[model samples]
Target chain A: MLYLIGLGLGDEKDVTLKGLEVIRSCARVYLEAYTSILTVRKETLEEFYGRELILADRETVEQEADEILRDAAVSDVALLVVGDPFGATTHSDLVLRAAKAGIQHHVIHNASIMTAVGCCGLQLYNFGETVSIVFWTDMWKPESFYDKIRRNRLSGMHTLCLLDIKVKEQSIENLMKGKKVFEPPRYMTVNQAVDQLLEIVQNRRELGEELALTENTICVGLARVGASDQKISAGTLQQLSSVDFGGPLHSLAISGCMHPLELDMLKLFAVEPSTFEQINIEDSSTYLS
Target chain B: MLYLIGLGLGDEKDVTLKGLEVIRSCARVYLEAYTSILTVRKETLEEFYGRELILADRETVEQEADEILRDAAVSDVALLVVGDPFGATTHSDLVLRAAKAGIQHHVIHNASIMTAVGCCGLQLYNFGETVSIVFWTDMWKPESFYDKIRRNRLSGMHTLCLLDIKVKEQSIENLMKGKKVFEPPRYMTVNQAVDQLLEIVQNRRELGEELALTENTICVGLARVGASDQKISAGTLQQLSSVDFGGPLHSLAISGCMHPLELDMLKLFAVEPSTFEQINIEDSSTYLS
Candidate 1:
């Protein structure tokens, strides 16, 4: 049996009791470490699960999947992923592969930033399409995600912007030199994401285009969600573009039609209560439950 | 401290180690019993945790909230929710109440259908706003949710329709008599939701109006997700309307634009492979990662 388990979005203890039990029963455990991350160290998880985990990078999980699935027909094997297995970048291909190989599999679900972002007070049902905001380079800056956010806003729906995380990636110089060296992992902070977002608005303005997003648009910055030290702040895009949200694994939500209840909740986390003066909060007190 | 812990979408074992520990440590533990449910019984959860459980129906959580938060400021208290704390319904209001009461609180996130629906081959990021389908009566057949689904489909994004569950609800007769009698729980099945959906499309057609949804629209029906006997089926809306996906807590996903990879995964659970003939699966082979 091949068990694909989710370790959730916090420390080692975030793994469910069932997931931990499966790990104990599995003959070999592999942790998929590419798409999402846990704030705790690998050693901490190892000590908690009482099993040595093999860190499966992109190559191992994508290229050497057979090795991960080997002998699964005879004994149990587990591939633990940070967040829900299919939440961030999906591992359904691997599950499909296992199905083709006639390997029985099960999925253990856990918290992903996808839904956990609602803790910041936005209603999950009100959120529109979620978009990923990648790290922009000097020569290559893509703003296609902006259009999606605009559409969501136009529909009076909230947009969740997933910040990019470049982990175990090699530099262009090293790739050209055929070096195996990897640059340090980089997680996009909400501040940098806001900067890119503001730049997009500025560029569109320069072209005399009226976009739904503006510097005064209301946005919420969330960092280290589901952790003890999790932080959430809400304000206009311009107001949050310079404010630091502390550490990594940050996400941003550009809200559209907000209910008074939502604004009331976001009000508790506002950087400046006065900045909310411009937000047009909808009156859904009669409907919001 | 007030701990709003999510018990993932399964049995008692689905609770995270952290959530379980907090429940054990809490002076009183209340389970939110209205919005969602776990397949396991309350007694099973009580036995596993070695504590007597208090079920908090809608009234207790909404009107008698002070009773729940009475001693939360001085001692630990937990409100265990079925899915991710903020996934199905916005618990932010309760959290807001706690904040106003000066009670420090913590949230333990867990798997929610909002994200877990991706397991059936849909991409989480491609999903748009979620809508709830309530059990319609002769006079109360509301189809306002149809507009939201149309908006989502217009944007070429998937829609996750959360089926409603009526637990501990009072009938009009019982209410008028003031007998305090409760109606038997009625969970909206995928078939019923589809019937209402099809009816709406028919009504719109009668009115000479166009809609993004139709009998031939592709969808996925998921039942008892995260359970050992979890079921996932995919086909055209007409094909899936009659299929039995087993017990409660079913969710339906209406697909918009599809990627080939998504089709491949959905194909494994296809009710009839021929139904895929109408789906224009996009070639995202080069970009999907």
Candidate 2:
């Protein structure tokens, strides 16, 4: 059997009891390392699970899937993923391939940022479609996610913006040169995401489109969710762009319509409680009791 | 400190190692019994955890939250919730109150239906706003969810309909008589939800409104996700309504535009592969390569 286990958002201890049991019994365990990074080191997880893990990069998983599934028909083989197994479409594709090969497989679900964003005092049911914000280059700035946020805002729903993380990425120059060298990993900060969002808002305003957010628009910044030192801060886009949310794995949420109760809960994380109150008054219709 | 731990959607062993550690050291542990249920009985969980659990129904958690948060300031107190701790808004409110009361708290996130629905081969990012479908009564037959599903369908996004479950509910007759008796627990089946949805579609058709879904619309029915006996089936709404999902806690998904890859994945669970192929050809635009 091939087991796709989720090593949730935190340290090694976040694995479910069932997942741990499966990992212990597995003959070979592979950890998909490119999609997301765990807070703890690989060594820490190895120590906790008492087994050596084979690091499977994107090329290995995408090109050598047959090798990964070879012995699964007779013995247990586990592919551990950060967050939920199906959080990424590639994992689903892997499962589909497993099915085609007649290999038995099971998924052990765990927390992903898709649901952990609720820790910022936002209701999960109230969130509309989630969008990802990729790192912008000098010539390649994408504004498609802005339109999604607008649609969600018009519908009075929150939007979760997953910040970008570039892992094992090759430089364009190196790609042209066919070099196998990889650049250092880069994680997008909340400030960078907000700056890109504001840039989109500016371009849209220039095109005479009504905007969903502004400098004073309330937003929440979350860093290292599901970890002990997790930090959540709520404030306007302008205020958040200046605050330093230490470390990687930051997420931002653009508030749409809010219930009074939601506002009350969010106020606890406000950079300046008085600013949050003033914004609530300026746009009273945005919040309902 | 107050610890809000999630018991993932499975039997007793689904809790994370982190959550189990917290529960083991906590002075008092209370399980919220109203929101959702674990597959195993309370006794099973008790045996696995080696500790008796205090069942906190709606009243205890909502009205007497202070009681649950009482000794957390001095000693560890845990409130166990099925699925992720913040899957419901009331839990967020409880966390907010804990913050206001100067109590330090932590949330141990776990698998939630919001992400676990991916087990049905539907991509998580393709899902739009999720809606809840309640059991329709003669007087309170709500059709608001139909509108949400229509909007999602129009946007070419899948919609996950969370079937409502009634626990510890008192009937109007009993309430009127001032009787303390409670009604038997009721969980909405995929069939019941489809019936109500079709009723709304019929009403909309009579009103000359364009509809996004019909009896022929494709849907997926999932039962007891994350459990060993978890089942997933895909077919038209008419076909799925006849499927015996077995037991409580069923969730339905209305398919919106599918990627050819998604269709391929979903085909593994099709009620009839030929019917699925015919539907794909008839509504080719609903899927993109």
Where is model 2 more than 4 Å wrong at Cα? A88-90, A281-289, B281-285
* TM-score, predicted candidate 1 vs. hidden true structure: 0.95
Ten contiguous residues with the weakest lDDT in model 2 chain B: B280-289
Deviation of model 2 at B53, angstroms: 0.7
Candidate 1 residues lying further than 4 Å off, grouped into runs, are A277-289, B277-289
Per residue, candidate 2 scores C-alpha lDDT tens digits across A1-289 of 8899998898899999999999999999999988887889889999999999999988878889988898788888999999888874348667777888889889999988888888778888888888899999999998898888888888888999988888889999999999988999999999999999888878888989866777778899998889888889999888898988988789899888887778887888898898776875665435654
| DockQ agreement of candidate 2 with the native complex | 0.76
Q: Candidate 2 docking category?
A: medium
User: Looking at candidate 2, what TM-score does chain B attain?
Assistant: 0.97
Docking class of 1: high
lDDT of 1 by residue, A182-271 (tens): 999999999999999999999999999977888878789999898788889998888898888787789999988878888888888999
lDDT of 2 by residue, B1-289 (tens): 9898999888888999999998888999999988888789888998999998999998999899999999788999999998888864348767877888999888899988888888778888888899999888989988899989999999899999999989888899999999989999998888888888888989999999977888778899988889999888998888887888888678899989887777887898898788677875665545654
Error of model 2, residue B161, in angstroms: 0.7
Worst 10 residues of 1 chain B by lDDT: B280-289
TM-score of each: 0.95, 0.97
